[model samples]
Target: MILLAAHGSPDRRAQALARGLRKGLERVLGVEVLLGFIEHQSPTLLESTLELGRRGGGVVRKRLL
Candidate 1:
């Protein structure tokens, strides 16, 4: 699983950019890329990580942007 960790933003434009990035990554990887924000968004970093961990053992690479 790929975990995209970001600082996040309250601005609409920035959020849009994040969405685009997630989509592009998912397309390239052919796997779901989950989004987790360090701040200013639902499903914080810890929450997302834990949820993914529950899916069983695997390497989760975090890409920050």
Candidate 2:
């Protein structure tokens, strides 16, 4: 699993960019890609990490942008 940590933004374009990156990564990596926000969004970093841990044991990598 991969966790994409992005700065949350109220701007629609920024949000769309983040989502686009996630989708692109999902296609290229061929693994489950999840989104987490540092601020101003739901399913924060802590929440996403916890969910990953709950899913199972695996090496989870995180990318920040």
Candidate 3:
């Protein structure tokens, strides 16, 4: 499981862009991509990490860009 940690914004466009990027990454990487925000958004990084654990995903690898 890949946990994508992003610096979130209140702007809707930022949210849309994050989702779109996650989708594109999933397509290109052929892996499950989970989106999480560091701040100013829903599904915070910690929340996403916990959710990932619930999903039975192991050895989370995080990358921020």
The candidate that wins on TM-score is 2
* lDDT of candidate 3 over 1-65, digit per residue (tens): 68788888888987888889889988998988888888888799899989888998754555443
TM-score of 3: 0.80
Positional deviation of residue 57's Cα in model 2 after best superposition, in angstroms: 4.5
Q: Cα lDDT of all candidates, in order?
A: 0.77, 0.78, 0.82
For model 2, the superposed segments whose C-alpha errors exceed 4 Å read: 57-64
The residue ranges of model 1 lying beyond 4 angstroms of the native Cα positions read 57-64
- Candidate RMSDs in order: 1.7, 1.7, 2.0
Residues 1-65, candidate 1, lDDT per residue (tens digit)? 67788787888777778779989989998988777888888578888788778876344666555
Q: How high is each candidate's TM-score? A: 0.81, 0.82, 0.80
lDDT tens digits by residue: candidate 2, 1-65: 88787878878788788889989989998988888888877678788878878887345555555
- Candidate 3 residue pairs in backbone clash: none
Once model 1 is optimally superposed onto the true structure by TM-score, how far is the C-alpha of residue 17 displaced, in angstroms?
Answer: 1.0
Please say which candidate is ahead in TM-score: 1 or 2.
2
